[model samples]
Target: MIKRILLVTRGCAPDEFVPAWRAAMGAAVTAPPDVRPSRVTAGIVLDEVTPEPRHDAVGQEWFDDEEHLSRYESWLASPASAAVDELFGRAVERDATDIVVTGEHVLRGAPWFERRWRDGGEGLKHMALATRAAGLTQAEFFDRWRNRAGLVGAVPIPEVARGQAYLQNHPLPKAAGDWPYDAVNEVYFDDLDDLRERIAWFAENLAGNEDDLVRESWFVAVREEVLWPEATSAGEGLLPGRPGGRGTS
Candidate 1:
C-alpha cells in the first residue's frame, strides 16, 4: 500500500469550512463510497497546532497502489473537485511513501473522534520529519531505530496521550533535488507546555545519540481539530465492530 500526505491550507475561515467538513464527514461514516476517493482504503485529517507557513492541516490517505492513486489524481483534475478545493485551498506540499516501519504506544487512551471540533477535547501533536545520514542503508537505519524504539517509549513524559513512529521507505519528494527527510515521528500531548517540555527533553537526551541515524530533522506541533462519527470514549475505536480495520466502504 502507498500513503499520500497532503498539506492543506484553508482558502476561507474555519466557520466557512465547518458545514462542508461536517457534510463530508457525515457521508464518510454513513456512505463512505459517495464522498471518499474510490481507491482510498483509509484516511484521517490532522490540523496543525503549531504555526507554520503555507499549510494548516495535514491529510493522510492510503491507497492500494499507484494505479489507485493515479485515478484519484485524475479526479482532482475533473470538474467535481471544486467544492473541496474551495474549502481547503490547494495542497501546498505532498508526499507519497511506503510504510517501512511503524510502532505505537497507546498509553492511557486510544485515538478517537467526536464528530465535531467543538465537541472534542483538544490535544497537541508533535511531529518530527527527518532524513537519514549519508552511507546509511535503509536497512541499517531502520534497524537502529527499531533497536532504540523502546528507549524512545521510555522517555518520562507525563503529558503524552499517544505516540507513534513511521519510517518511510524512501526520501520525501523535493523540487530542487535536495531531499532532507526520510521518516516522520509523531507524539500527542494534552497540552502545549507538555509538548514544549518533551522537545527540550529530546534535545538534551537524544539529539546526539540520534545523529548517527538522522542527518536532519524538522519538528512541528498540531492540534486535534475534529473527528467524525463521534464517540463518547477513547476506546470506541475507529469503526464499530472493526477494531483497527481500515475504513473502506
Candidate 2:
C-alpha cells in the first residue's frame, strides 16, 4: 500500500533548474484531479548529476513518497502529474522516470520513461522497470529494485549517452504535452483485456505514422515499489527514486 516514484532528469544545465522548477510547480497547479487524488505526498531531491571521475550532471525529480503513494498515484494519473510533466520538459535536458505505489487502485506502479536530448540523442532512459502485473514475486520485486538503485552509487547519469537507448527509442516516441508521460498513461490497468487492447492500439495505430514527429508511444505498467525507511526518518526531504545531483549523493 505504499507507492514510490523516482523521476531522474538527465543532461540538465544549471540555468535550466529554475525554469524547470517553475514549469513543474506551474503544472502542479493545473493538473487534472482524476489522475492524482488528494491523498498523495511528494517531495524533491537535488543530488549529484554526474557519473563520477568526470563529474557530470544527472537526473532529478519534483517529488518523492511519504507513505501516501496511493494518494500520489491518484494525483499523478490525475491532471496534476501531467501538469508537472510539462513544467519539467522545459527545464530538463532530456527525461525522467516515474515510480508509483498503489493500495486501493486496481494496478500498481514502476514504469520508467526517458527523454531524448535536443540533438536527437537519447537524453534520458529507464534503467529498470517492474511491476506487480509483470508477475514479480515479492522477493524478486524488492531485490531487483534495490539492486538497480544501489548500482548507481553516488554519481548520477548526466548525459543521454550514459543512459539506455530504450528510454528514447522504444516501440515509439511519446509526444510531449502538458502532462507527465508516466501519469495519465494507459499503461496501468487491472484488466488484462484492457491492457491488451491498449497495447494493440499502439502497435496497429502507430504503424503508418513513422514519419510523424509525434507518435503514440509505449508506457509499461510497474507492479511494486521499495522505499528508503531512513530517508523519511531523517527528514532530509529528499525525493525518492531520483539520482544524485551535481553535489549530492
Q: Pick by TM-score: which candidate is best?
A: 1
lDDT of 2: 0.30
What local lDDT does model 1 show for residue 215? Answer: 84
Q: Which candidate should be chosen as best, given lDDT against the real structure?
A: 1
Query: In the order shown, what is each candidate's alpha-carbon RMSD?
Result: 8.6, 16.6
Worst 10 residues of 1 by lDDT: 37-46
State the C-alpha lDDT per candidate.
Answer: 0.45, 0.30
TM-score of each: 0.54, 0.28
> Candidate 1: how large is its RMSD?
8.6
Q: In angstroms, how far off is 139's CA in candidate 2? A: 4.5
Per-residue lDDT of 56-111 in model 2, one digit per residue for the tens?
12222222233333454466566535545654565554334442322222122223
**Candidate 1: misplaced stretches above 4 Å?**
8-56, 62-71, 90-122, 152-180, 227-249
Q: Candidate 1's error at 92, in angstroms?
A: 5.8
Expressed as tens digits, the lDDT of each residue in 74-117 for candidate 1 is 65566665544433332222242223222222222233321222
